[model samples]
Target: MAPAAITLAAEAPKLSSANTGFMLICSALVLLMTPGLAFFYGGMVRVKSTLNMLMMSFVSIGIVTILWVLYGFSLAFGSSNGFIGFNSDWLGMSNVGLTELWDGYTIPIFVFMVFQMMFAVITPALISGAIADRVKFSAWALFVALWLTIVYVPVAHWVWGADGWAFKLGVIDFAGGTAVHINAGAGALGVILVIGKRVGFKKDPMRPHSLPLVMLGAGLLWFGWFGFNAGSWLGNDDGVGALMFVNTQVATAAAMLAWLAYEKIRHGAFTTLGAASGAVAGLVAITPSGGAVSPLGAIAVGAIAGVACAAAVGLKFKFGYDDSLDVVGVHMVGGIIGSLLIGFFATGKGQSTATGVFYGDHSFTQLWKQFAGVGAVLGYSLVASAVLAFLLDKTLGMRVTEDEEVSGIDQAEHAETAYDFSGAGGGVVSSVSAALAGTSKKVDA
Candidate 1:
């Protein structure tokens, strides 16, 4: 008798309708963050530069989206030996059908592509805050294009790609402590080093022109961050995603309170700016550790980052670096705090089974790994950004003219202003006319 042939059965991957819907919603939420960031930074700049600020963030959405679909996604998420993903299978998303699902993921590959695209869009936009009010819009647009290709794509590959060196080394970055926050913050510092300070740096009082806009931006950011943090799980798992959601809220609230307390004690007042800044610091701090920590751990991380970021923001005055909007302080510093603190606070109960040192694990292994990830991204982003800025300054000029900057970047770059107080008289006359028209017979007096 002939020997019986042996066969094995394997389940093929298919699209998951529920996870697909969740991811698509998450992608939309993440995309909203860019415009929310526009308002956040726009309100912080003087009114003259408001449109420029909003444009810088808005342009990233356009430039990076094109690049991501063309080759950026291939470089970031495609198959490779390691270090970088440069494969043909996913290039231009070629040969990928709408029904195709990502490996080990329940959602369609298209949904995952869009979700990650939002991340790439916002990371460079974060740098706009550091060089606010002085950069040329054209140069910025060019920089975003080049930087995403040269710096962001490679760093993202190293951190999150399946064969990524950092991933293989067991470094934990739930979302983007190293890849997004630290990368953008360090890049901001690097560019500022080359661009020099705004024309009246220390002498001028460049207070935010619109706190209401800032608060609105902050609210939008807070609402969208739920998708940002929880959705990193890539699935609607009740355990990890729910934990991340709760931790995100708790951490943000804790950071806000901690920042207000710090400001009240240090400066004798709880300013609105402090509350907004503190909330952002918390949001940044929890981005990397949210999936690995408990609600209590999130609070601890948030409070620590809030206080640390508050102190770090003042360093620009001492160090003579003109980080216009404190990106380095709140993003880079806060990212480091959150990343390193996860080494101690991780409970080994969410997402991964690896416990932190403070969770009775009794080792500094994860801490060192976190440092390695942070150091690699920071060093690379800083040096690469400085080179990009220097080349742009040499070739295209990175700064607006002194006169243009003094008057307004909105007019210089876009030929428009954010507001027209000249219309105030017309508005007042119309308001009075409406009032008079609405009045009854009492007008006899």
Candidate 2:
């Protein structure tokens, strides 16, 4: 090779330990979200279904990790015709080099691969909340595998892949509002539509068994979301990641307050559930727009999503499709609100040159593009997910027996209960008898 060519090759971006370390930490943080989600969903269900709810989220971590290593990464990030991607070398992550950097970034290909894997892990886990108590565990696992392959991989390619149609069309999803939130939310809606409602739709008094667990889960999700939103930039070379970090906090706080206010006005009380749900709504809304909008814009996104999602939760009752945990209300609606608001809040200054309607060179062009991205993902996920659920419901039986569901899916499905009431019963009786004996002795004295 000529000297000039050799020089140019040698000058290629070298490995950045700083960026690699940042991403590794970020990857760990993202992985924690699956467990966080487990706690969040687990706490929201009846005591009879708590273990099942937690397992649904936990299972996705195992299933998606294997798939992502095998061919999921290749199909998602490989070069293709803007729909799906495949590179044989990346099929098993076989040909990737440890020193090789992802194109346009300092992090290694493996780091990027694992980082994306966490995203894949949690997206399907998000759907489990909707079908909580009734679905068979085996059927749910199959759905996760198929949905990740059929629905998530392609939609991810569309929005985040280099040659993706949505990427090429200039859709601004800084994180995963369209690909993750909307996709999961729509998929939840579709599956529930097919599987029908939980046995006692209106008459049963199904309340959350544990609010403390719910609060703990929400706190974890909030803590991990900083990495989820900021680390998308791949490096801290610029201040964009920092900006995203700030926006994440601002938006979450704003959404929480907005939700509490709305609850106080509408329900006449400030409930803890509302606070947790509202914070999550803010997180979802700001996920896509944080990189493109200012802090104030993030506040707008969070507040709007908080109220909209808070109100949207009621739609399940009105429409009569049983979304046990309000996935449709919070994630789907919040994702749409966040993605579309980017067209109005984007300043063309933070992460991209594209401007929103309320920003420089105000135009509706970005808004239309946002619509296209949202509509395509939502429509495709809705249809494809329903079809997959229908096939599974017909073949393997998606739901447990009605008796199993009414009694407790944990025992029927996993052969164990979340709480051992037999021991508790004995303890309670012993205490009552001891107290009665003490009272009788005191009276004799």
Candidate 3:
């Protein structure tokens, strides 16, 4: 037999049960991060708006799940134009057989579908934090539905789908630096600009109501992020997944320290909120570069993102847009750092063969590609989100009444309260009033 014939005969692709099981578990883990996000955001809002925050995240799971199966997946990953994927054959996954495996992928087609579905669900939910406390729940839902279709689906296709414009152009987003983080961040900015600021933007004590809840949510996110980063490889056979997992940990740890150090130098206090925010910033920073960069590179990315995001969070104060929970600062800013720095830090040794400028490859080509990917997603998401928010605002009305917002969105929107501390006693009521008065006095002071 000729050598070529022997080589072709020696290579056979078979489905591995182990890879299937690993991916299924990874899908489940990624799904958990959405609820964890609910807690993280819920605790940041006032006690009254807590359930609404949680509801915002929870509702994405329900809405996006149905949409993803019906056609969202097709629009995102179907075989079609490079800029966008929309094949009727993939509508409702009709063309996908249960026994079918995605080409060149080790897992079943359905498993991969669900995994990407989880990502689609959470991307829009990340925008909710920017407009917390004052948004009408129904309007927010409508925005999510529209934004996902117009902005997220196209961007997801561009970055991830086979033959995607950016994918073909050599952009390297191992996870979701552009598609998820920058997309959501810019979308949040657009919606917030349309919705305007919370009633008390600069003057109120909008401090987190419960640090414990925030920490719990952060812990869940940290645990689940292993899957979020490593699972992108789609297979554990290569040591790339292992490297991603380690990079995720060390980057997050470094970020937390960097944020605390910054806070101590600037604000003179190391708040629990800083630790949690730093951890999330780190996670966002490493998502794109973790598999491509070394542990030291991860640390550098995380540390830069931590400090940059910490400072960026204050931009709302300077620019006078109320990003209620700093989603723009952490997700968007950290994402840009991670995505762009990969242009300098990526080693040609990893799964990605592209070498960075700093790796002595001495070319800015990869850097320009990164910028193009980020710019395309950011610009598209921003304009699409603004249009959606404006349409929703014009029709359904996006914000609650001023009275409803001041009193609390939970009762006005959900007809429920997060805490029933009202029924405690007469003494408790007086004490609580006095405490609030004292807080107001301090704000004035």
Candidate 4:
């Protein structure tokens, strides 16, 4: 007769009604980040194509949302082959029950479905920033539609889904360090290579039109990220889940501070973009380790992300590649930093148990796994994305005509303006003058 079996499981740990509500709330909060991202990217481009950027994200909601309901979830989460979900028969989930694991209080599968669909939607929209100011809206829509079918759904299934090949291979991505960040970062690079540099790129100084808009976008992204990290806990445990929530907030704050501090020390004035970008860098870094590591661990991850991402964004200068929106800099660099540094810090220590350099897993092995995951995702993503881009470029064409890019897509494609302040003033827009504006700007369209 023993007093107890004495184990982490032996303790009758409990989840709360309040916690359940909080998680559902968090899911909704994260879903909002897609629109927030739209604003973030939309505001960075020149006023000429502002609405186009906004629509990239919004259209994702329409395209991916419908696709997810049809079969995206089955391809992603249904029990099946590791590479691609073999249970295409589960397409509509004709007889599926709610999502539940050995752990209890699992949210309704439909709730989980919508939350993840938002993630799928946003990942492609993130790339639009790299190729903005060009890409015909119809072509962009078709690309996202097709890219989702090819690149995104398969990668997501391989990374996070239960039957995912990467997960089966024992790769750990707590919250899309590889799936969302690496896939998108590398995919952006492949497209940029084919799409070519921004017209004025290094040859002309193309300043961000609105730093305030950038900062606004960043603030919303940070606020929404708590849901992104904490909602992954699905079980709603206090000790582990609570730790993740606090870590997400603290790491973001620290990274933001570190970034502004770096900017102030180096550039004499802390720009809004620096602060906003810092927060995103921190959020991306902490994403992978949030559920499994501690607050202190989060700090190290955030600090490394801040410094590394800041420097990575400057790589375009040295490497001579145009990652137009710093997707490579922030997501790729930060994702790697977080994935690897966790190897050194994720110890199963008191209060923050997980095992890392402090423990005896030896940083080398853990670090290698991180790099292996990165390389695997990168290599696969580059080839696959290049193929997709080539097909699109050759068939329907992934790029806009030089003339269309110069004239801007909003007027030429949509025949609409983002803000009709002029309309509010009872003034009609000058179609001929707008037409002249498009054709006269170093373009012959």
Top lDDT prediction, candidate number: 2
How many angstroms is residue 98 displaced in model 2 relative to the true structure, after the best TM-score fit?
Answer: 1.1
Off by over 4 Å in 3: 1-12, 422-445
Return the TM-score for candidate 4, rounded to 2 decimals: 0.86
- State TM-scores per candidate: 0.93, 0.94, 0.93, 0.86
**Over the stretch 180-252, how does candidate 3's per-residue lDDT look in tens digits?**
9999999999999999999888998999999999999999889988888888888789798888999999999
- Model 1 per-residue lDDT tens digits across residues 69-145: 99998898876856788767667887788887777666777888888999999999999999999999999999999
Model 1's TM-score against the true structure: 0.93
**Backbone clash tally for model 3?**
0
User: Clashes per prediction?
Assistant: 0, 0, 0, 6
Pairs that collide, model 3:
none
Worst 10 residues of 1 by lDDT: 1-10
How far residue 108's Cα lies from its native spot in candidate 3, in Å, is 0.6
Q: Residue 43 error for model 3, in Å? A: 0.6
Tens digits of lDDT, candidate 2, 1-445: 0000112455677789999999999999999999999999999999999999999999999999999999998998888769998878889898999888887677798998999999999999999999999999999999999999999999998998888899889898988999999999999999999999998988899899999999999999999999899999998998999999999999999999999999999999999999999999999999999999999999999999989999999999998999999999999999999999999999988988888988854559999999999999999999999999999999999999999999999999999888774453657666777788899999999
Residue pairs clashing in model 4 are 346-355, 347-354, 347-355, 348-353, 348-354, 348-355
Q: Which regions in candidate 4 have their CA more than 4 angstroms from the true location?
A: 1-20, 88-90, 97-105, 349-354, 424-445
**Candidate 2 backbone collisions, by pair:** none
